[model samples]
Target: MKTAASSVISDNDNTPAQSIPRSPRLLETLLANLDGVVYRCRDDAQWTVEFVSEGCLQLTGYLPEELLLNQRISFLELIHPDDRQMVRAHVDDCVRLRRRFDVEYRIVHVEGAIRWVWGRGVGIYNADGEVEALEGFMQDVTERKEAAQALQEAERRYRSIFENAIEGVFQTTPDGTYIAVNPALARIYGYRSPEDLIVSLRDIRHQLYVEPERRSEFMRLMEEHGSVSNFESRVYRRDGDIIWISENARAVYGDAGTLVFYEGTVEAITERKLYEAEMRHQATHDALTGLPNRNMLHDHLQRAIQSARQKGGLTAVAFVDLDQFKYINDSLGHQVGDELLKTVAQRLMSCVRDSDMVARQGGDEFVLVLQNQTEGDVGIAEVMQRILAAVSRPWQAGDREFHITSSIGVSRYPTDGKDVETLLKNADSAMYKAKEQGRNNFQFFAPWMDTQVSNRLEMLISLRRALDQQEFKLFYQPKLSLKDGRIIGAEALIRWESPEQGMVAPDRFIPFAEEAGLIVPIGEWVLRTACRQNKAWQDAGLPPIPVAVNLSPRQMNQALPEFVANVLADSGLSASWLELEITENVVMKDAEKTVATLNTLKRLGLQISVDDFGTGYSSLSYLRRFPVDALKIDKSFVRDIARDADSAAIVKAVISLAHILNLRVIAEGVEDEEQHAFLRENGCDEVQGYYFGKPMTVDDFTDRLRKEAVQAAP
Candidate 1:
């Protein structure tokens, strides 16, 4: 056994020798095949080498012949200057202990490049106690040493980053067991320390992450790409509060490159996720009521329509308009109006299902989108009735108990119209019908409602043309004094004789004109024409009964007093010869604005009268505040004064109220002797009715004036 081992060592370290030893011959053969040099050298400052192999030439870039047997360079000259002392010290220390010496150091090669080498030597002691030689092995170990140094540097750099990184860094085993974690990781995991996290969070899936699938997904991504990027998932903190995190990770491999564990970093993104969700919600919701707005309504309705059409079911779009909203807004201020709208919106929303949508179209208008229904229009009607009842219930605002009402109009998808705009228009038209039936009502569209819609469209078209073609004319109705039976004034009334539809009455289209915002222009034209015609009457030797022109509420507000002043100036008529007849409802539309406008009108020296008095709800105390000259009893009272005691009482009350207000009185709608006699007995200052004379054409009116003037000759 010793022979075999000696033979193996000799073959691995063959060297030149004078003795004919079989081991040496085998060693020579092995040394010739080796990648290291075997040498025998004297222990001295410049150790003289007795023999060297060809491997030395490859290691130090020098020939073996140049360093052999003290003939030329020695072994000590091969070492780098900076590492030579340390190498020498280690070698001496090993030699003094009479043991094997081993040293690794950098060497300066013959070519002037640096090389690292590992030297091992066993000192051979002579019997006289002097060092004979150092027989050892030397090889090129520069590559291994450099690789070890580079690995150490990389470990240090990674440790520094792991300790200081903002995102958490961690390492876990393949079974989702936490192996190691940095301080950042510990804090992210809501642990007191890194050790605490590694100990407590043994099972990452169960202990750390809220969803176990996230860990599985993490494993999946690692397997697919050997890494992960922005792997977001929800995790529970130590306190059990969930938070969102994003991970950049990699699968760590072992010695054989089999995946052993997952190494990753995670960053919290809870705030960013919350902000994105809020942004999405705000984009779809109304800012005022925090409900779905028109934009969301369109999407919801479209989807519902498609579903209903496919299933042969019902979907409705009901347009809800708050009744008398304008009056409430004008009287109570917009703050109160806004509160009322919010209350109504909440109540209306409560009456519908979560699947349905309640959207505010803007200001007192809402559009409800109803979803699938098997009962078709019946279901829509029931829903609308429920919503109307809910919204109209009494609400307390501040200290006042206020009662509100709504007009609801429903149009079904595929039944009323296929598209949103058409359905909305149809619903709006039906909503007007709801208003026409005196509000607090719901109207489902019928075929006759289409006729009213067409009429309105025709009226709007005629109006646009009326301004250009001069088809609209002013007719004067004489207001005669009751005592003298002479023309005290005349009322200027609008008469439309369209080329298509001739002879439109004031009652038939005036309300439509007011709604369309065409009344301002039409009313201004009436004022200017009446002022000019009145001056013309004076020019033609007719009595100038200050021409009275009725002003709609819209006209009174939309046209400034300056516009009226300009019209009066342009017509070259005296301001005192013009009277503006406004209804009590119109004057009380906005008390402050109305008073300001009336004061401006009064400054122009024009007489102002409240028309259709005792009909609208105006406080008698407030009536004294108006800048007006007279009050006209509404025709409703006169229509039934002879039959209804209530009508007579209303008429008498209006006259007394006008007198208390220090305003003159005029009675309208006096067609018979009873109404006239009743109004006269009530001390009404004047009367303008068919009992006096009916409204007539300009030529006939002039003829009557001639006849009256002939009778008036004294």
Candidate 2:
């Protein structure tokens, strides 16, 4: 085939005399082996083919002689129908100009195949410069054209993915310069466009990453492992805002094993990071004040001890307790109590260095860790002084200004037994000592401090026995109707009658019982006893009046309403004859749960009263939701109502508020006629205080009821 093409080339150089048909073997051999057709045809409408090479059989599935001079088919018919007019116009323009023409168009083969072909040719002219014939070479370039089109379509698809993907995609050099970035990348970084991002962000180390070391870490990972996944970092956006981002990236290498760039995808994980942080904070810190809680405090204390041991320096664990916090909490409300805690937390933080740790060890108790104290007790004393000053500062809740102080107990490391538990115990013991020695002062642990703990243990044992021995007795205080001056109801107060001791007041044992978790059982006993006694009185032909029993905070659980219903049923007493008194603090603790419980109790037809109404931080919004029937003004207000204008105002306001809510108002501790007249004038429905009668034993109360019944008999 090479020799034939060489001979054809030699023949084309021959003059006319030498070209006189020397068998035409070389030209015929070359044409027969060629892959494309060589043709000449008239430049007319039919595109008459005058001659065609042997390669026409392969190119168009037709023998060379079959298409010669319009013998069988016109060459124009082989061109695609849609492209025929275009082909004709192109050739005509080229012919008129007498220049070579090149075009690509589809053609049909005899076997019903459509193939793309490239045609390059020039015009042969006759006299008067008119076009006579056209000469051209056509090649079947279908495979090449299809390959080129496939490449273009693949590029278009990749471009679409780069432009429209939700995750940001980027390509950058090893030295922290961006090479290419997609639209998603620009949007993720708060940029207007990809071009704008590329132009503005030049240094990824300083300009993009909030911490420049993150970029170095990224490059180090790529260099060592060739890829990185889930590499999270805090970065600065185009708007100069910080956000969290996670990257999945790999090194893109050149053919010579050199790193061309780093290609990666980025996800903005700011919200995810924030949510995780909140979860972690909630786990380790107090939700109310955002201070480290007991769980975190233990860990921090251990770490501080370890640091102190290694440095051979002293560390102080100071247990801080707010003085009279419980009184303030019970008298004012838990809302005020929480505010006091938060205020104390801020002051405690202000007293310590940045290296110190302040942690909340449950309610009203905080623990501080003062580490690296080489100056011994003097340094701790200075901090303690500062703490005392800060905590003693005046603060306000509502319209009233309050002065608060803290009692701190300090235990030095190595001196406090060198462990987290021991240090905390000693500190706590010393805190109690400080409280005993007149609060608002600091105390160091003494070896004899174990007495306080032993006393607590003894009280727990006695309390548990007191419950088993039925040493608890109920005393009833009569509630008098202010309008008619007659006893209408009575409050059942629990009294502990110990065998080894005289009568124990509620305040002496109730707090210990509550802390020891014996309150729930004790409360149940009180309820049962009160119900049975009231029923006995009614059975004995005495005038029946509603009997009120206080519900402790711990006893106000999901089981209380059902328990009360069962007690009423057991005693055979009408629900209308029973009243359950719940404290304001108890009701406000979990408002939704309290509402549900109160509604259930209400369904049982028992009278409910908010005991100590003005004392607690009860919101009127939640107050309206409670299913209580009355509000009991606390004895504290009535004890000095006539002497104190504030007390008088509070009593009147409560009476008005209760009436507005359609609830009955009862005043307690009305000791004189002046207080009674003040309450009666303000429309107080009932008064329960020494003015009417003191709390009496069951026998005394039964006798008194009988006397009243006899006197009422007309």
Candidate 3:
């Protein structure tokens, strides 16, 4: 009988009988009907096919006669270009191990279509166990291969989203352990890496949240609602830094409705929180001194009134005005003025109890509300005295010591009025009275003081209309050279001819102007008018002398130098023909800045002079440093120089000092020959007063100049 392995050969009469076996019909039927090809080939380079089954037509769309025996194409030619090496290596490995080979790869079909195929093969051996030929089966598996590739792509997309999200994404177990966290989550918690944060932060309730209650609250919300939207909390980072966070999360559950874990996104909101806080503070507090402003003060005052009324207690509303604050600001500087106000605010706060409040009512003004002052004015009086003493204590600004005082006006509830407006008005009126009484004192509100307040209100209103109505004029007074007894220059002074109030002097309305902040514009008008008039006189072929203009303390600022230069250019006048006279105290204020400003003016070729000398606290050291060309003696010393030895000594010393410093000295307010002779003998370079010429209108001054020009023609 023939072996079964030999019976698999075809019935064709080409093969030798030794290569065949018995039972050929059954074996051939099985190989032909099976779903794949069964092949036999020599163990050679081409993996040549020697015997092929009928199934070759179904697997590769080629008949057995076409592929067997290398008739038309070798079996290796059917393998795909990309999978040929892998198929050959698998067959070789199986042959070396003496085992069957199994692999899945691609093959080119007869119709030129590429198809995925499964292959199996084994090396044939003789009795001596030496290889003879190879055999294998292959079948189509294209659908299964495509399905696997699609699955891999989906997984890759999911992983990318999890890794690169901007909002911190997290998954945590119900027991408060982190299951997964993205890189963004690591950064939000100030961690070096997501692994570090997940491994280290075990107790989310106590470790992650700044307040443990926040985590508890989050859990409670999720338990009831199964989700939390826009839940806000303060959280601690890995470095122990606190920040605000907003979270939107939901409870994740299994298919059986059992709690699985929590998943969420987190966003940082610390910057938004801080911005809101800053806006709230700016809305209710003074920006300059960081004190409660007018809006907050009114609210507090009303609350105090309501509480005092409920308890049947007394409430005192004290209005505080800084004494000589304007003088200090004008003579010193605004920087110093602001420092003084801040210092005064702190002192006022110290003088009051915790139940009391001190609020800024605007510049140089403060309001205090003392609630439950059952002892009435007596307790209020004590507080006022304390504030007075506190403010009067000397403070230093840039090595210069200075003192300030306050005038307080107190109005009691039920005595002044029940409402906020009436109480504030009464306190303000009494404050003015305190100022009138030489300041540095306190006064209680009286009913009869209404007229003074009314008068002040009326004056402020009328002054506003005065500038628009053109009720202002300038007067010029001649300055005479003491040596030549001739008119050298003229001082320009401002006067108001009001329609309602006739002939108002500067002293009356200038204070109102300064307080209302209208002086800057008014001062500019004065400067332009003086420069234009001086130019007009020179154009008329009159003597060209320097026209001196007094600069108010408010006008003596850094902007003044540029403004003066512009006015000279616009008026077509030479800067050399203008003299700017600033007060001694104004120059002494902020010595460094004043020096810079004075140098700028000097560069414009205009003359700079110190007016009203000896009336203010003038330091000799600073005086030598000023870029001034002239000094004007104040009338106080000039009035009594002949009678008073001290006044004579002061005048002589000033004149001598000015000459030594290369500054020309002019004595003001010389009313008689004796005062004039005294100033001249003491080396006064110039004189200006009634003795020389009084302040006259433009027309009068022009006439005087013309006559002097005529007299000098000889």
The best candidate in terms of lDDT: 2
Off by over 4 Å in 3: 1-83, 95-168, 183-196, 237-241, 267-279, 302-312, 411-426, 444-714
Runs off by more than 4 Å, candidate 1: 1-58, 61-78, 132-135, 154-175, 179-185, 208-232, 246-267, 302-315, 322-344, 353-355, 362-364, 370-407, 413-422, 435-441, 451-714
The TM-score measured for candidate 1 stands at 0.50
Per-residue lDDT of 98 in model 2: 78
Q: List candidate 2 segments past 4 Å from native.
A: 1-33, 38-41, 48-74, 108-114, 122-132, 163-179, 182-219, 227-249, 259-284, 323-333, 372-395, 400-408, 432-442, 451-714
Ranking by TM-score: 2, 3, 1
C-alpha lDDT of all candidate models, in order: 0.81, 0.87, 0.86
Q: Summing lDDT over every window of 10 consecutive residues in candidate 3, give the lowest-scoring window.
A: 3-12
TM-score for each predicted model, relative to the true structure? 0.50, 0.54, 0.53
TM-score of 3: 0.53
Worst 10 residues of 2 by lDDT: 14-23
Query: Tens digit of lDDT per residue, candidate 3, span 570-679?
Result: 99999999999998668866788988899999999999899988665466678888899999988867877887675686688778778989999989999999999998
lDDT (10s digit) by residue, model 1, range 1-714: 346646555567755433336665667788877888899888887888888887888888889989986556678888888987998888888888998998888888888999988889898898987788889998889899889989999999988998888889888888888887889878887899999987787778878778898888888878889999988889999889999999998888889988888888889998767644544454455444667766667777878877877887777888999988888889997557867888888998898888888988766899988877667777777888888789878888788888889998888777889988778888888888898889988998765787566778987887878877898877768888877778888887789998777898877778688779888888878888888888887888976678898887887663568888998889888999999999866876688888888999899999999887755445554677889999888775687787766557556766776797788999887888987778777888888888788877778778888788888888
**Which is superior by TM-score, 1 or 3?**
3
Q: Tens digit of lDDT per residue, candidate 2, span 1-714?
A: 235545565667665544444446757777767778888998888889988888788888888777887677889998999999999999989888878999999998899999999999999887888888898898899999999999999999999999999999999988888989999999999999999999999999999999999998988898899999999999998878999999999998999999899999999999878745654565467655768877678888898888877878888999999988898999998557877998899889988889989998877999999998878898889889899889999999899998888898999889876899889889989998898889899998877888667878998899999999888889999999988888899999999888887799998889888878999999999999999999999999999999999999998888988899899999999999999999877987899999999999999998999997765557677889999999999876786577667567667777877999999999987888888888998899999988889999999998899898999999
Q: Count the backbone clashes (under 3 Å) in each candidate.
A: 2, 1, 0
